[model samples]
Target: MLVYGDIETVQTVKEKQAAVAALLESVRAMPPGIARHGTLVTLFIGASELVQGVVDAGFHERGFDTLAPDQEAGMACLVRLAQEVDRSWRSGFASAPPPTGALSGLRAFNPDQIIRTRQAEGYAFYALYPESYLEAARSSGLGPDTRVIGIRSIGMSLSALVAAALGAPVPFTLRPVGHPFEREVRVDPALTHRLTSGKSGAFAVVDEGPGLSGSSFGAVADWLEEAGIPRERIYFFPSHGAPLGPQASDRHRERWRCAPRHLVPFEDLLLGPSDSEGLAAWTASLLGPLEAPLEELSGGAWRARAYADEAQWPPANIQQERRKFLARAGGAAWLVRFAGLGESGERKLAMGRKLHEAGFTPEARALCHGFLVERWHDARRLDRVPVDGGHLVERVGAYLGFRAGHFPAEEQQGASLQALRHMATYNTGQALGDEAAAALTTSLKDAEALEAKVRRVWTDNRMHAWEWLVLDGHLLKTDALDHNAAHDLVGCQDIAWDVAGAIVELDLPEEATSRLCELVQQHSGYPVHLDLLRFLLPCYLAFQMGACHMAAGALGEGNEAVRLRRAAERYRHLLRQPGIRQEQEEAPAG
Candidate 1:
């Protein structure tokens, strides 16, 4: 028996250690005969020596012989496995000798199998960048017309070498839009035009493995289609299945088969049927299902409904008036931030459409608005203009009304976490202050109760927390949350609770303030919301200082008096603005 946990997926050193430890412990519990011989293999491709050392030490301490294969060793292992490939046309897959150890299964098949399979199919190889398949691709003796396009990273470098070996006449590469986790794959427009410009032949889109989503291949397929290439010309040659070599889903195969596109499984070329099926079943059982496709939900019709709901004031009407009113007024994109009676009308309208399309309509609307606070604050800083924060509050208040009527208990709890975070980071007290506090208190109480329910439901279950929030897509308007998301919400709620406690009394500890600000800044960079947190840092600090000074009073004369005056000055400096200024002005001076 062998156990392996690739360290690539984890985010931190501690997490990697924990994962290794868990694997070791699991290995320990097996029967002595099996456990004693079990070799713990840690594949640290592209990992640091420090990480490799830690994994080695951890495994060594457990009295297990471990192997952390290097690039040379890994590539050597692939070549060694490829040596046994039966290139003869008469050799049936079953007649081929099975590969074992370092070259076992689709996940660890010989990289050369890619070129071998392509040769067998009579099509040119198109290796996706970032997989260790180049040595095999290069050695396969393909003609000079092979074309490979991928990212300009290490995996792609190896791929390029293989392409060069094949005497590839034209190889194209482009930087993907963002990190792989970001799931944003847009090939450069120039690259797209270049790829589609003149070449005409059957081309295979090669990738190392079609992971759970098969998204990399899908992205290329989409790009090719957009570039006006017939889908029939595109062939998907995923070298392996997903990480654990899961079976390609019927849906995934169906998707690729559209427009007569072919999905040629390299596993079929690389592994015997029994071993491939066994590995596929094992991985399929492990991963269960991929995230539901958001595209399946209709976007156009939902956008229409969202537009119709805004019958009161269409953005087009506002834009028309803006053009009529101001001679030098900019376009809608420029005016969207400032053009609204309450919230940014254009933003709200656009976000409403996004929410509806995502199937998180009613509840997502709140998350979307919270996202805007991030944008508005960023614009405030970059533009160096005092934007009205009260408008944000108004949008939140409307969402609150919607939440009260439509949100499930679980969703309300999740929203409560957002509410608490919003209040703490944005100084909700200044704009909606007392009202915000009252809402925070109530939402916290609800979340605390929900937290208790969560504990009771999963007391002994160590299931990953993300599973708790997978919204039922069947329920069109349900909140989009999974247990993992639920856990995230709870964690944020806990942090927000601490920050809110400190802010309400103006006795915020420096540590608490720093933590609150850190979280806000970290979350601001998240894809869903940009620049939405910590917009009220200065205001909150001033409020805290004012409260401290007011509490100290005349007991501390000179410095305390100075602090009090400064606090008052900060209050005057606060940009209450056109939204809340009228109500604030009429109130008694504190």
Candidate 2:
């Protein structure tokens, strides 16, 4: 049975023509069994006309007798449901800002790049927008018995994809009313009856973009909740990234100032929200007006069930803008490992470490360094005391330091400070360890005095609110130990490998327990703290696993011993490096 819905799918005259062609092609290819059902459901006259065309053409060409929605009882029910939803939407109209916050730049909506890497990476591409959306009935984690409800258009597609992935049938769609972009959605009485009649359980709420004017998706979410569905059980496979401002703090409050809570911009879905509204506005200006509710909204067989509303269509210029935007679509922000809500230093560091483990050293270093630099810059910006001086003096003194031939005192602390100190030690002209030691001692001598001065500057009641804002915000965010943590974590791995090699080759046992405790004391938060736990556990596991294999004689031939031996040799070689030698020599002499 065909279910006809909204008329907004085909707006301008050109779209009408295209819709007709696509409908004919899809209908002509319909399976014999489905055609034999003889019912083609449509929502409004605009949709009914197209179905009638398809039926007339089928009969004239192949002697097939297909019934239109109005002619069949089951199909008529669907049309009635669609109209009921439309009437509800017309009663309530709320305009919302476009979901432009997500699409802050031109290169934010490319699905191709994201999908291309899906096979090589374990990203949730197909899971997010299942290819079998038309037939899926359930999702994997949601269990086989679960059912889903979708918002019309994007939600419908997402539900279908999710259901298909779960080896289920097409999910039910909640018909939207009024302008599709900013409509109030209503649950069809029939659907409500079907859900309420059920032996009561949770169902999923699927939508492509949670655009502005959340009433459509919100209606379904509310209905599901009211129907006794647990909030967590109401699965939201929103194809787009979250709407802006849901998680924004004062720092990023202005990021997507006017972005709609429901709207999911193609840019935002592919790329995380823009850092600034100017970037989002510029992207909008470049792309022109928003045409379709989403860029991926297309003329699929399922979409043909809905009718066209010319009056509610976006302007021609907006249509043109969409075409132009699609023509230049390049990269998606979601393609990257992490692109959501708040900025996460832990996720960034983990990603960097993962890259390093995979032998992508340059990328790993770059990722780690980028995060460090960002944090350091944030810290420096926070150290401002406008009453003490303005931007010029602060920048010069914090970075260049007033004294000649001296490093900026600001550089002594923050996320990258440890790495900077290490680099300095390794690259200096001093003797292997003596000069580095002397420099560190000298730097520490002034530490107590610098700390007191810093505390006074920041806590001084004379500072303006704006100045304190920067200072308070910085204090809350700056991490002074991330670099130290990274070094220690990487060092632990190296030491494990070194100790293993020493035991087998040099017959020496290198103690690692004390060094580990010291490392933990250095980096205590997320990525670093968790990283030590994750990396250290794996190292111990690998060592034990290899040892067990050796003891069991599993390493007699082509077993893990061969791999362990190779690992030992690799570590032996690494330990001979100048940096490794320095680390071992300067290891507190314990």
Candidate 2 lDDT over residue span 233-312, tens digit each? 55555544544223223322332243222223334333234422322222333334323222232212111112143222
* lDDT (0 to 1) per candidate: 0.30, 0.29
What TM-score would candidate 1 get against the native?
0.25
Q: How displaced is residue 286 in candidate 1, in Å?
A: 23
TM-score of 2: 0.25
lDDT of 1 by residue, 1-590 (tens): 00001111213444433443443344344432211111111111112121323333333354432232322243333233223221111132222222224222112322222110001000111212121244345434445564555332222233333444454533443223333323334444664676677667544455454443555556666667778877766654444433311334454456654633222243332222442232222222223321221111111122232233322211111101110010011111111111221112223445444545543333221211011110100011101222233332222223222322232232222323233334333343543456754553443344333333221111101111111122221212211122112212121122222233223223334343333334432432211011111222222333333333333342345443454445444432442321111121111111
- The 10-residue segment of model 2 with minimum total lDDT is 115-124
Q: How does each model score on TM-score?
A: 0.25, 0.25
What candidate 1 gets wrong by more than 4 Å, as runs, is 1-44, 47-144, 151-190, 206-219, 225-228, 239-255, 259-590
